[model samples]
Structure formats: structure tokens, C-alpha cells
Target chain A: MVFICSVATAQLPINWIDPLNEGVLQGRLADNDITGYNRLPDSVKSVVREPVWALGTNNAGVYVNFKTNAKEIQVRYTVSGALDMPHMPKTGVSGLDLYASNNNGEWYWTPGDYRFKDTITYSFGPVKENSHRIYRLYLPLYNTVTWMEIGVSSDATIEFQKEEESPIIIYGTSIAQGGCASRPGLAWSNLLGRALNTPVINLGFSGNGRLEKPIIDLIANTPSRVIILDCLPNLTGVTPENTERIDSLIQAAVYQLRASQPNTPIVLTDHSSGFNKNILDETDNTLYEQTTQAGLASFEKLKQAGVKNLYHLRNADIALDINSTVDYAHPNDFGMVKISDAYQRLIEQFLR
Target chain B: MVFICSVATAQLPINWIDPLNEGVLQGRLADNDITGYNRLPDSVKSVVREPVWALGTNNAGVYVNFKTNAKEIQVRYTVSGALDMPHMPKTGVSGLDLYASNNNGEWYWTPGDYRFKDTITYSFGPVKENSHRIYRLYLPLYNTVTWMEIGVSSDATIEFQKEEESPIIIYGTSIAQGGCASRPGLAWSNLLGRALNTPVINLGFSGNGRLEKPIIDLIANTPSRVIILDCLPNLTGVTPENTERIDSLIQAAVYQLRASQPNTPIVLTDHSSGFNKNILDETDNTLYEQTTQAGLASFEKLKQAGVKNLYHLRNADIALDINSTVDYAHPNDFGMVKISDAYQRLIEQFLR
Candidate 1:
């Protein structure tokens, strides 16, 4: 049977979207609830602190909302950067509640009370029922409070009838993990979800992202719409041997992803600017450019070998300027926006 | 006493002399010694694990022997981002080991074995004796070395030589702390040192460098060449009230520095980039520009009232193209070099 892969040529209309409400859900004890002492319970809340700015979620779920037709349902959210708290503590003694509702306000609660937060990321799958769902993230560490978003996913053509198998997975460094960004919603992956109106699984580890076997194994297991490999910046002072190792690691990861989700798109990126232009010698410049080109070449090679979807972006195309860099390397808020925009544009262009 | 400052100026030519071992010592580790360990105890007669590199010293007392004088010293070295250990460990380690020797052979034994490590930076003290000196760094923990650098300073000029002294204090976010640079040498502050050819105390804290009072107080107490402030990145979600507080904090720090140093210089910098060209909202742009301009204007008002050596670097001046940045915000190596050059030029054109 010759299966024709029809490229979805639907162009989502561009709308003036409001930024996601990337607010910190402060976990404060109720006025009369503290039984042990006068002090309030130290709520383990993820406060978007760096590049401190206000982000609000719009009423529209155009960015993060998704739909499909199947008996069971699956939902996911991207969580990047280091887990604000190390070792998701199980002793907090709070109930782990999943509050999900289709736009119709009909909510479903799990049969048993579950309490697990080990991973920085999560996915709820095979919901056993189908509906137009809007996820509401809630944690009852100290007390339960609803999350406020600066923006939401826009409308899509797909009718909410059943579950869809396709997923989007992002693999990268700190930015993927949400470094220096003000909030989780502002993270590019999350933003990308809002733009595409799909569920994305984020595999961004802070400094620990090295494109190693363990990480690739995780990527291999997940089905995704695209795989973004952004690991160069963290690989500072990487030698030729390590670089080669990374290349192979990427190949291995791509190979695994293909085994599961064939024709999945792959995007590779180089380290952003942190070097001094005045000091770049011809040899160093050539080598650096070659390293970047080689990564792209490899992706192209994969495409040639029938991997249809692959992409590459240079740090230069982003908004980084050495002078503008808050530190010699890390993007300040200004830099983050530029990076997000660049990622947005690329993804949009690719999807188109 | 119409004593001539020219006496000091006449000796400026001495500043051009290479005090390090022909720039060889300027890197993180030298290749001459098979034993990578530098400043190893001479008493140890045998070697088991030969160090990957050797440490070199020059005849001049300055460390690394690049260019130095009795009044100043230059340190250069490479730092491997992929080192086996963390770049700057914060534990029993007081700081990085730094030693100065006028006689190259004497680098083995300098009084107190001055440790350049500080709470958040590498620092040297009041040079007890005024003479030509060579400085050496002993990093005991680093294993897989990549890059090296050297730092220069003259105790007589910045510390001991002055009855009343103020330091050029830099207070800001990670950019001030030298983030994302391949090595410590590539950091803008280190580069700025080479340009100013003077002792500069770096206080760039990584993610924690908020424009807070404790930090401001720390800056206030130090004798400074000038104070360069860049903290908007860390102050992401700051409200008008908090921003006003930050402004007051700057004013207080500057006032205190002036109280001690009297005529020291103070330069303020604003956030370099905002939303990039895509979201070029005039209001946002105006607000960001005005915020920085207001900071400069405030300083100028103080300058008009007889405060000498006060300046501000506009965002336009600091924000270069994306090529200059590694990421959208952090500078690449080339960006570092450019930023260093720009800063040096700015200092030469205005401060000096």
C-alpha cells in the first residue's frame, strides 16, 4: 500500500495574542489554617523570578488548547529549566490533584488521590474520555490556588471528538528548561504550544543537558511533532572528541525518534554568542562555523535519507548582541524575547 | 605644592612592558610541564599523575607576565567550561591562589600566599611593598583544563598609594558577574582590566545580582575607578515602586562612594535590547529608553551640580547586532572582545 503523506497546508490566521499570564501562584496558608505555629507554611511554589516581569494569560486558549478524535485523551505541558526545588519532595503531605476540564466546564477527577512530583515534566494520557479539554495546573502543597495565565491557546479547526497520538517534544539546554525567563508560560516551548495550539513535552534540563545517552533515551521513548536539540552553549570548552560524541548522540537520538515517530522534524542549534569578536582568529572562526555547518549538514543528510523534516538555526539570527548581553553570555530579558521570537518565526515558517 | 601628576604620567610607558612570560603565562595552564598541577610543593620529589599542563612565570613580578608595572599588572589565562570541577567553587576554598613575584624564581614563595578568591570574585590586597611584581594563579581543583587568563593590579595605585580611595564598583546582574564567557579571561570585566590597565574590583553576581541594598552598600565602601550599573535583566518584574527604589539605591551607593572617594566616576547603563524588531512597540521602546535616559539624566543633574566623572552608556551604544551575542543576550567570544573594546574605548574617550 503506497501511503501518500499529505502535508497539512492549513495556515492559521495570525491574531494579536496577549502574553501568557506567567504569574507565580503564591502558596500562602489560610489565616486560620496554621495549626502548628503562628508562622505560615513555607509553600513550595514555583515563582517565576528572574527577568522579573508580569505575564498574563489571555482568555483565548488558542496557544495551549488542542483537539482530536479518539476514545481516550492525552494532555501535556512543557516544563523547562532546573526544577525550582530539587528532588520533588514527597513528604509535603499535600494531595496531588489534577484539575482538567473541557471548555464546557465538565471536569473529571482521577479515581484515586495521587501524589507524585519527581519529574520536572509530566503528561496525563488515555483520559478514558474525549472532550474539548482546558488544563488547569493546581498543586495543594500548602493550599490550592488556580494558576493565572497571561495568554491561552487560540482556536483550531480540529473538532474535539477523541484522542490524537501525535506529540511535540523539545530537547535543549537551560533556555529549554526556562532559564532567566520570568515564568513557565513565557518559555519558548510553552509559547510555541500556544502558537501551534498543541501539547508539547519539554525535556530541557538546566546545566545537565549534554545530549548524553540517558537524555536521548528519554527523547526516544516519547512521540513528538518535532525535536529541538539546543545543547551547544552548555557544552562550553567542548573538545573535538566531545563534539563528535555529541554529534553521534544526536544521531542516535534522531534514530530512536524515527523508530517511534517516523518523519518527526528535528531542529538543531549552536551555542549563542559568548566569545569576543576581536579575538576570533581565522582558524577559530572557520572551525566554529564548520561545527555549526556540520550539525546542519548532518540534519540535511538525514533529510536526504528520507527524514523529510529537519531544521537548523544559527545564534546570529537571534537577537543576541555581545554588548547587549547582561553577562558575557546569558541572555537578559531583552535577549530572551528575541530568542523566543526567532524560535516562533522558525517554527511557524517550518509548519507552514 | 604644585606637584606634577605628570610624574605618574611619565612612568606610563612602563605600563606597556610585558610583565607576564611573553603572554604565555596569560592562559589558564601552560604546556611546558607534564604535571598539570601548578604551584605544586617543590618538596615532592616524585610524580605519579603528570598534570596535563604547566604553569609559567616571567622575570617581572606581574602574574602571567603579559604587561604590568609597579602601579598595575595584567593577568591572562584560558578557562575550560568543560573542566572536571566547577569554575569557582565556594566551600573550604577561600578563593583562587594568586601570588606575585618581582623575581620570577620567587613566585614559589610570596608572603601569605595571597588568595585572589573572594565571596563572589577574585581579589588581591594592599601591596605591602611597592615594587615590580609578577602574579601567579594556582588552581588546585581544576582537572580537564580548557582556557586560561591573568589579572593585573597595582596595590600602590588603587589601595596603598591613596590616603582616600574609592573603587570603580560595578553592580548589576550576571553580565556584571561575567556569565557565559568561555573562560574567566573572556569576561568583559577582565577585558576591561586590560584596557584600563588598572586595578578593578568585579562584583558581578550571577543570577542573584539584584540591585539590592546590601550590594549597594558593598559598592559604596569600595574605592572605585568608576561605578558601572547594569541590572535590568535581573529586575525583570520590577514595578514602578521597585524601580524607584532601585534608583534610590543607586543614588545612595553613588553618594556613599563619593563621600569616601570624593571625585570618583560613576557610569550607569540601561537594558540593551527589549522586544526585538518584531514587536517594535513604540511605547515599550520609549519606556525602556526613557527609563535608562532618566537614570542618565539624574546622574547628569548631579554632574551639573559639580559632580565630576559621571556618565551613562545608552542602550543604542551597548546593543550591537545579533552576531555579537552567543544567545540573544549573552555575548559570544567575539561579542566579549567587542564589548571589551567598546568599554575600553569608552573609558579612554571619556573616563581617562
Candidate 2:
């Protein structure tokens, strides 16, 4: 095992694994798709529905019975990304749905029902935690999935050392919060999590997402693999002064975070679509472009000043065209998918 | 004066002659343009600072200054379209700004301001009671400038007489309640009012727009030129049964309203965009498309059943593309302008 040391004198073991470059395979499949059954047994359905009705999780578990014989496996996923959070369900939703195939072709089911909770750890059957070959984890929500730490066993024969838990943090306004996602899993962030197979923390506030210091301070405390900054749509009619202030605020936050976690990656994102068109001359487009450019410049300046982990996602033509929007500015689900896919690609290519 | 009594019992008088459309000639100077003057006077600057602070009947005095001998004029404005009776500001904002001018330069300007307290007659200038020759009503906050009734003084003069004072009524969820319009004038309904140069009573209840019978009843009591329905976006995961129930509720309301205002126009609008492209498959798109088609069919039934004034704004391509949206659903300012412009064009051609 390689132990990395931080530049700051604070003595803490640093587990720095390159999330962007590492060989990680993450994905998800719905229960019915995997199990070929639409409804769980009445008893299981009652149990699942009990919690579902008590408190809806944006992406809640849809039970699946695995029927495979693979031996050992590792899994990763992101819980949330750029989707709106308020609309996402909070309690009663389990993160991952894990199923195993013990008696092939015979019915595969859990021995007993487990109550949903914020955190839980478990080992299945006689299989060593590290040696279990075939397993599945159900992810029914977006934005709240914090980490994809591996489940391990003490036995040396079955090696299951949890990977470094550095998360991708998304910061933005309502869209980041998961607005209009009919279900939690449908949010782009969750979709991205399914695509990249990594843990993600959603920090998207509804209308309160301004690049303020307090929020930044909270974010800096998190051990993040990457930080995505997407704001400005909420700052409509914002003048240069306010934009400058926000830029500086972001810069200060990044610097503070860097002081603690030196090479943690940071990616700055701009407001997508709607504001780029020439609806009323170039005023709206110019301002949006200027603010975005200024933000990128600030990030670049930080990089020049020796902040090694910083990048920016430039405005894309697909996101700027008129057809990209549902109304004018807000992305429809299609747009969300496009953005999420873009972020995932960028992170894989650059931050990794 | 020609008072043509039609088959409908409502007996609405139609004198559809618009001054702005009568080759009245517009000037190069726009209302909001900053050309010619390097800087505005202190008073103008101060007023511009709180452009939308004062509104409704109480602040009618402020709009008086917009009247000038200029051919075209532009003004920054904001107006709340939510009805005053059940006084509450909707969660989102909507508005617009545009330049209005007359070629003769003889048009009188008296920043006309008035609130709709119950009902009040609006006559511009000293052209006697209902004798204005050519009047242009500019609603900056509403992003609409329309020509009101003309030709009360002479037969050759173009005239627009309000036979019935029923306004164009809108019913829907948050979008209908005016989400993220930057200002009030940009709302599609408000823009429609400006295009028609007529009074519009907004009954948009934010999240509470559920197509309830009471709301339909409330709208039915008022005199209305048309009814615009846009509500599916708010019904996120409603079951087919609920959708049918809502549709029935709308039909009931329409039935009652048509019974009273027989020939009044009715326009039904469907959800713009919601399907996230990444997750979009044949099933989801088919479901959404089917819902919209069903909605259109229901509206058409009313038209076929002796309702001559019924229309439907097709859903395909009506909403700005998913990319233009700020989130997956709500429209940004640019999206709002696009939608409003589309409605304006549609109404112009249809109402003609």
C-alpha cells in the first residue's frame, strides 16, 4: 500500500488514488430488468412499500434477485451530481441493492429484510466479504450518495481493501439540486454516477446557490476527488461587480481548500444554454461569455500560481443552440443527460 | 357602428381594427435604446434603479412619463400578473420590454397606468369618452406593446371595441404562474395580451395549479376572450387515472365557461419538454406523446361540439429544446422570449 503525505503539517494518512485514471468499472441495472419480475413477493413488496410511503427517496431501491455465478467483484457509483436536491427524496431510500446467486436457477432472495438507514454494513452468507464473486448494489437516488468504499474481509485470502474515498462534489443552483427529475435516479448526477461508477455528493441548493464563503467552507472540508462549480443562471441581471466578487470568492475558497488538500482536482462550470442566443442583440450572450471566461481565467491563474488541480469546461455548441433548451434556459431531461455525459467525459479525460 | 349578432348567445361585438397594423408608420427611435445620450439624467437613473418597485393602480402615476413625440420608445419595466383578489406573488417572475412607435408622431403619450379593480374603462388622452383615434398601450414589464381600440371618432378610422370585458384567462402550474421571467412582461400570457392589446387577468397559482373545479369555476365567472391551459409539467408522476381526472375537471370547466361565453376562444397548451434524452427510450416518449395527443383530442372534442373558438398549440417543437432550459423543465429568459414570441405569432394569425 502506498501512503501519500500532504504538504500541510497536519498529520493525517492521505489515501490519494487517481480516480480519473484508475481502473474502475461502475454501473447500475433496474430490478425488473435484472430479475425479470415486475413485482416483489407480496411480503417483500409490503416491506419496501412501507419505507417508500414513510419517506420517499428520490431513487429508492427496486428489488432485484441476481442469478449469476461470478466469483469476486468490486463496484463504485455516484449518488448525486448536478440534479436538483430538494426534489430528491430524503429518508427511507436505500443506496445500493446487493443481490447474490447462491442456488443458480433456484429463487435468490435475502434471508431477512433489512430496515433502511443512512448507513449500514453487512456480510452475506458464508462467502468472505472480500471473496464474494457475484453481487449487486441497488442505487435509487442521486446527489446524496457520498462514497463507494469497498466492503472488505479480514482474511488475507479474500482481499477487499476499500479504495480511497475521494468524492466528486457538485455545486450549483436548482438544476444542481435535481429539479424536474421525476425520480431520483433520473437526475443527471445519479445517471453520471451510474455511468462512471463513483461516489458523488450533491451540494446543489434550490435558489440559494450563490458562491458564498460559508458554503465554500463546508465544501472545503470534504475529501473530494473533484469539485464542479456551476452557477450564474440564478445570477440573472448580475453586473460585473457582483460577478467579480463571486469570482474572487471562488478563488479564495479554492485556495483555502488547496491549503488543506493540495492536489485535489477542481473543475469550474458555466451556466448552460438559454443565455447564449442573440434574442436581444449580444448583451445577454456577451455578459454570459464574459463571466464564464473570467471564471476560467481565475481558475487558470490559480493553476499558474501552482494550484496543479484545476480545469474548466468550455461552452459547447450543442448546449448553446436553441433546440437544446426546453423553455429557453432550463435544460429538459435530454439536456440534463447531455450535460451529465459531458461532465463525465471531461472528468474521465482531464481530472482522471 | 356595426353590431353583428352571431349564432352565439354571448353577443360579443367584434370591431377588429388595430392602429399599429394600419400602416401607421413606426419610427427608428426605440423606447429603451441608449443611443444619442451618453448618460441619463439623475432622475431617470434613479427611476431606472427601481424600475419595477411601484406597480398596479396605486402607482399609475409613474407610467405617465413614457408618453413622448418619439416614433419608437423602449422602457425597462416589471409587472406582477397574479390576480390581486387572492393577493400573493407567484414563486417565479415573468415580464418583457419592447419598443412601440407611430409614424405620424401625432400619437399622444401619457404613461397610462391603471389597475384592474373589478373593471374600469381605460381611455387614452383627451379624445373624449371612447373617442381615441389611435392608441398604443405599452406594458414594458409585460414585454408587450399593443394598439387598443381605434376609430370611435369616425367611420373610416380603424376601431377596436371591447364588446365584452372578459379577459384572456390562463390556468396551469408553476410555469403558468410565471417562473423565472426576469420580469413580468415576458410571460407568454402577458405577451399575448400586449399582442392583442387587450386586458388579461392572470389566475396562475404556483404549485397549486391542479386543474381543480373551483379554479375553473372562478375563471368561468369572469368575461374572457380566451382560455389558455398549460398544466402537465407540474403533474410529475401522476398516474393515468389522475391525469384522466384532471382532464375531466378541465373539460367540466370548459363546458361551463363555453356555456356562458359561447363564442370565446379557448387554447390548450401541452407540456413543453421533460424527457431526459439519456434515459429516454421508446416507452417514455410514447407515454408523453400519448398524453399530449389525448389532451389535444379532448380539446378538439369541445371544438367539434359547437364550440367555434377552440385551438391547440401543438407540443412538438413548441418548447425550446432541452438545452435552452436552465434545468430540465423551467425556461430561462431566452426560452421565455422564444415561447412568448411563438405564442404572439400564433395568436396574431389565429385571432385574425
Q: By summed lDDT, which 10 consecutive residues of candidate 2 chain B come out lowest?
A: B56-65
For candidate 2, report its TM-score.
0.36
Question: What is candidate 1's lDDT per residue for A192-232, written digit by digit as tens?
Answer: 55456555555554565566655565566555667778876
CA lDDT for candidate 2: 0.44
Clashes of 2: 76
Q: For model 2, how does the per-residue alpha-carbon lDDT over A1-352 read when each residue is reduced to its tens digit?
A: 1333344433333222222222232221111212111111222333332432122222332222222222222334343333222112221122333433222321121111222333433223322332223333334433334444432222222211222456677766666655433333435565565456555655555455566655565567667778777765555444767667666866887788778777777877776743442222234455566666666667777778877767776667235443233334444344556678788888898655
Q: Where in model 1 is the C-alpha error above 4 Å?
A: A1-167, A172-199, A204-225, A229-264, A268-300, A313-345, B1-199, B202-309, B312-352
User: Residue A50 deviation, candidate 1, in Å?
Assistant: 32
Model 1 Cα lDDT, one tens digit per residue, B297-330:
5566677777667676666666544234322344
**What's the TM-score of each model vs. the native?**
0.37, 0.36
DockQ of each: 0.02, 0.02
Candidate 2 lDDT over residue span B1-352, tens digit each: 1334445334224333343343322211111322221111122333332321122111110111122322212222223343221011111221122212233322222211122322212222222222322333323222122223222222223322221334566776555544544334445554455556545555444455566655565566656666777766654343677557656865876787788778777777766653433211233344555566557667777777766677777655465643233333445444555566666666666665
- Would candidate 1 be rated incorrect, acceptable, medium or high by CAPRI criteria? incorrect
First chain TM-score for all predictions = 0.50, 0.53
